[model samples]
Target chain A: MRYKVRELTDMQNSALKEIINIGVGNAATSLSKMIKHQISIDIPELRVEIIEKVPEAAGGADKVVSGVIMHVDGDINGYIMMLLSEDSAATICKAINEEEDTDIHTPMNQSMLEEIGHILAGSYISSLAEFLTLDVKISPPMQTFDMLGAIMDQILIEMSQNVECTLFFDTVFVLEGKQMEGILLTLFDPMGMDKLLGRIDEMT
Target chain B: MIIVGMADSAVAKKPEKLTTLGLGSCIGISLYDNRNCIGGMVHIMLPSVENARAKDNRAKFADTGIPDLVDSMVKQGAAKHHLTAKIAGGARMFSFSSNSNLNIGERNLAATKEVLDKLRIKTIADDTGDTYGRTIILDTETGQLTVKSAQKGEKRY
Candidate 1:
């Protein structure tokens, strides 16, 4: 049965939020370890919105962001995006590549960002998998620097074919001393909502 | 100037531009009439609207959006015979998906081209089917379409 995103009950919303909160915590911990600094993440926000409103979650439709895109499959399939402002990306890259490693060049910045993205995503998805008892596999990260709306258009086009609305888990993170902020977004497959809800119920 | 959102379409006249941002796998189809200096752009999400559980959004699918865009341009003083088209976007962002159903970028572009042909709109230029995303702007004044991307910089057609 097809489920309307807007119809999610308060209890369902709370459950999903809690689940995502755990995932975000794990991601933050992994990031902190990699950067060798304290990282703090804001309370994750969960919402069900039309595709157009998604860009607003990251800032605006025209907001330029450094994005790392990946697809999650196996039990519950969907798209996961790690979006960072150009400044935040630069900050993270600088922190990670602090040593005067001559090997790191201009184009290597992108590779460094992708590596960080992969580490964070791996932690987040693995947390979700362990918590939900679902085996989820993630595709390799594809990096892009562009307007958030355009990056989203890639995933939302395929989604719009089946579901009119999408569910997103949005989290903001700040590197404690640096105060650099980034947003991590998870656009859950609308078709997988039923399966996800069922799994949630099983947990409770 | 008019800004088309996801699954939306807009029309404009001379000196006005139509813009849409972040066109990953979605197709941004623009129809311009040089004679009248009128233009219309549609951000179509799906290949076809037929069998869609939700038929209310005509601009959300190629089959319906292309015809509707043509009709709107004709109504707004654009000469049907003078209309030409340019399109951009339709990128396959995820490379690891083995599922053919995930090849929506190629499907969307093919379906858009087919619909444009059926409507007799001559496709003048297009930048589609790549791993990168694009933001497109259509100039009604000159019928010049600008495609901007972070990886490839910008191009005008």
Candidate 2:
């Protein structure tokens, strides 16, 4: 049976929220160290739904570009994606890399995506592993810079099934006193849900 | 001198050559023959082996794209034994956590080397690794390879 947001028990809801909170905290710490600047991280607003429901949840964002995707397999199969606007990405890179100029050229743009991909995947997966006490392997992160349509097309083509669940969140990064926005999307299969719930149940 | 832009691939015959400008972590594999002067260039994006959605875009993956380039070169009278290979690109553009799984650039270089070795084609030269991008050019007429790196300038690799 497909699981919806409402189907989640109270315990499950709190567990998921805690997992995201920890992940965002780790990400903020890493960003602070890398950029050598004081940064603030906000708990991502979380929504759980089937993959097909992503568009409706995405809301009125005119475009979705500069994304990184990491696929996980073993016990469960799913994907973790971080999406950002090109402008926001440039600003973040300038802040982190200490670049005087925040121009987003092809080469610099690619490098920024690589760095962000590493941090987001690292923190998210580590938090999940710690919460579940299960070691999960992540594939190399792939960065895709394209329009919303192209991004959605690629996701649909790769996933091939609309039955999967998606966890979406928006992370606001305050770096050097400048606020930058980033979005994280985590996909989980039915099997993944079972594994996640099982682990949470053990915690209680 | 033929230039292959980003997301572009090209082939050359005797007296002609192909090149790709500015390769950052992206790999450039040159297939050439000293005798027939038939060659091609592929600037691949990722190092994916699985036939995923990118399989449709042959230029995106090394596993599928490299073979396709080889087959096309052979059809143009470039024999396996007579062919020489040269590769460049694959740089660590940024610093990240150690736990991040596959290194796409490293994987691209490794997959390219392995595929060429299996085909019994010796890699005449290569300039890979480091944290900078490169501009690569191949001369089908003379089998000369030139690599221009971002920080180090241009040189023959």
Per-candidate RMSD, Å: 2.6, 10.5
Q: What is the TM-score of each candidate against the true structure?
A: 0.90, 0.53
The candidates score, on chain A by TM-score, as follows 0.91, 0.85
**lDDT by residue for model 1 over A3-106, one digit each (tens)?**
56788778778988888888888888988988887887778778777875677666876677888888888887787888888878876776677744333226
Q: How close is chain A of candidate 1 to the true chain A, as a TM-score?
A: 0.91
- Which stretches in model 2 have alpha-carbon errors above 4 Å? A1-6, A59-64, A157-165, B1-157
Best candidate (score: TM-score): 1
> Considering only N, C-alpha and C atoms within 3 Å, which residue pairs clash in candidate 1?
A149-B22, A150-B22, A154-B25
lDDT score, candidate 2, position A148 = 35
Residues B34-78, candidate 2: write the lDDT tens digits: 888888898766666484432455765677777878888887777
Query: Which structure among the candidates has the greatest DockQ?
Result: 1
What residue runs in model 1 are displaced by over 4 Å at the alpha carbon?
A: A99-107, A202-204
Q: What DockQ does every candidate get?
A: 0.55, 0.02
